[model samples]
Target: MAGRFDGQVAIVTGGARGLGLAIARRLAAEGAAVVIWDLDLTGFDADKTSFRPASAVKVDVTVPEAVTAAMDDVRSSFGRIDVMVNNAGITGPVAPVEQYRLEDWLRVLALDLTAVFLCCRACIPHMKAQGYGRIVNVASIGGKEPVPGICAYGAAKAGVIGFTKSIARELAGSGVLANCIAPAMVETALLGQMTPRFVEESRNKIPLGRFITAEEVAAAAAFAASPECSFATGFTFDVSGGRATY
Candidate 1:
């Protein structure tokens, strides 16, 4: 069957599990030949699904050299990168600002903020040259509102939102669109890093009375990276499920 992404190539970061994995699968199902960049590739086999990534390359997104090399490899193999999903992230030690460790803060920012920069930096040129591209950064509702204990996470995601806007404007007429998803508390493995009390409190705050799902996020991301998303750049698509009043 023909699909929106037929004959296109996509690259999803941190796709070994959780949100990244779900998004990767969704892109593949839509007929985009996908590539996964992660530290682990155990989840994606050559025949895992009717549509799967052409290659699941092991990558450490925090490292500049590795990200550059991986991006280059994908371009060399596919001739173009139509979609770049910066979905790799970590919620560093969920604690108050005063209790957060310096290392934890830096680590979270490195993976969450800086890695997004690295991937976008590597992809912008290829996209510009082709005159088309979609960069969907997975931000968080915590970035827009206050999530209290997860100071580092909130800060990093806020940066992603701002960064997406900046780049979207920069590439506005250049044929590349940049946007982000600000979803509320998603019950993924990432939740395992948070305190049970913290999780409970977060769930209670949601007006919908439930957390987000990986599949829901994936669907939103797919739209942001689709040709139909042509007019909505520099925007934050709220997947907060009624939690965000703004």
Candidate 2:
């Protein structure tokens, strides 16, 4: 039997590691030609047997020109763009709002929020022309609720939710669907940087009492990108291990 995403083409930003890598792997396993876009090119193995040799492209999503060039390259190589996962993001500094530096805050916003806009702006036109597209953006539980010590990261993710909703409405008539996923304290390398106390606190707060695996998030992403995900644009899927009741 053929995979669900057979013949589809997908681009996953920050696909080198963490949640992005898991999503890329899942999409590829489902028979989509996958392009792993990231800044760090070291040891980034794109499983060629699963997808179309898994193109590994170095891209900084915050830079519009770079994003355009990367997308163009994907288009040229893949022949069509069917799905995009905006998963590149950074948690800058852990500080109170009063102690947050302007530069640090700006950097977080640029990467976490602005880059999503840039990618969507560059890719939506092609998707519109084809009359089919699926966009899955990675936000966080902090986007919906309060998360202290990471104000900039939280705010940027919240912006992603709003931006995705607006664009989802605009493109609903054109056969392109946009959605965002909000996960809380998933098991990624980035989580290692969190203070032990914070980690423990987060785990305790989760009703499941455990950190969500990257594969869990990947499953949600795959569903959102699937053709069966019709009539669900502008929605937010929660993968917060029951931490988010909304």
Candidate 3:
């Protein structure tokens, strides 16, 4: 289990902090040279960041051009991209669907959902070229069990699940494998986007009676990105703390 990603390169979007950061740290600990993509660099100081053999890149995952250029830079600097962890996402303001602003809705989808598509589009070619790769997308239990207030977040995540499944089928014949982790509520910075009532309600829904930890989600992510995850593609590994019904 140790050094499962030895001598490999991993790209983790939104990895400056929170769950993405935890996942990046786990990957690096497993010997993958991790490239963390984030809009903010303040928290990514390699010396201060909780990881080794890792670098931080400022790239907007929501932008195709930025993603492509960043990937090129990673390829040029690191030589190859063996693992891709599309962990970038957001939960827009918690509001009723009708009350949600159009602009906010678009923004949520742009980053939470569309960004995954763009990152995957940019990374898939590189992975295909390598003839071997692992893709671990970070989805949410909200995608399956939609909450009432956060329509944008839930819808975007549902799209991610669908996209992951489709791409998994497309790449199954190839060397690259794709899968996603659908986690229940995790205590992370993104929680700021949700209302207090919503958060409390969500916690109550978890059969385990508690929120998931970022490290727990990261552990699942590490496995999805490992070489041993060969048999399952397009699979949704649940980190729902008993919240997931299916």
Candidate 4:
């Protein structure tokens, strides 16, 4: 039996670990030839070894040349890009706005917001030419309901949600769809940046009483990137454990 993504070529940014890894694994399992883009390749071999259709390339998504070159390499290797998951991000400087370092705020915005813009800019032409594509951006619940002590992270993610929506509108006639997943407090390495007190407070606010799981985030991403997702571009899927009731 053929999988949902059989013969598709998928690119997952920040796929070396965390939620990105889960998204990459899911896409590969569904039969897409998965190309991972990340700065750190540590533990990346595990995915390559476990999934026959998976590979990784070193990329700094914040760098336009790097992102373009990496996408070119992916095109050269796989011939076409059918799916693009913008899953790379960082939670920078978990501190009050008054105490936040300017550099850290800038870094978070670069990775979490600007990188999404760059990835979309680079991949859109290929997708438009191919007449098909799916773009899934990983946003955050904090984006919808800004969290204190992580204002920079929240602002960047909020920008991502808006960016995806705007692009979806622009690409509506191009056969390329763009959507995003806004998830709450997923138990990934990003959590390391938060204090225990912050984590507990976040969990308490969630009606479900817990942080989201990486696999859960991946599942939503997969749906957004699948062909069945037709008719639903520029949408934000909330996996915030009831925290994002809107």
Off by over 4 Å in 1: 43-51
Query: Model 3: clashing residue pairs?
Result: none
Superposition error at 45 for model 3 (Å): 4.0
lDDT of each: 0.91, 0.90, 0.90, 0.90
Best candidate, TM-score-wise? Answer: 3
Compare candidates 2 and 3 on TM-score and give the better one: 3
- lDDT by residue for model 1 over 163-206, one digit each (tens)? 99999999989999999999888878989998999999989888
lDDT of 4 by residue, 1-246 (tens): 239999899999998888998888889888899988889986666735465435778899999999999888888878899999999999887788999999999999999999999999999999999999999999989899997889899899999999998999999989999999999989888878878898899999999998889889988999999999999999999999999888
Model 4: CA > 4 A from native: 47-49
Better of 3 and 4 by TM-score: 3
- Specify the poorest-scoring 10-residue window by lDDT in model 4: 45-54
Candidate 2 per-residue lDDT, tens place, 58-152, comes to 89999999999999888888889999999999887777899999999999999999999999999999999999999999999989985888899
Give lDDT tens digits, candidate 3, residues 1-246: 678989999999989889998999999898899998998877665567647546777898888899999998999999999999998888889888789999999998999889999988988998999899999989999998889988999999999899999999999878899999999999998778778888899899998999999999999999999988889999999999988857
The TM-score between candidate 2 and the true structure equals 0.96
Q: TM-score each candidate.
A: 0.96, 0.96, 0.97, 0.96
Which runs in model 2 stand beyond 4 Å of their true positions? 46-53
Q: What TM-score does prediction 1 earn?
A: 0.96
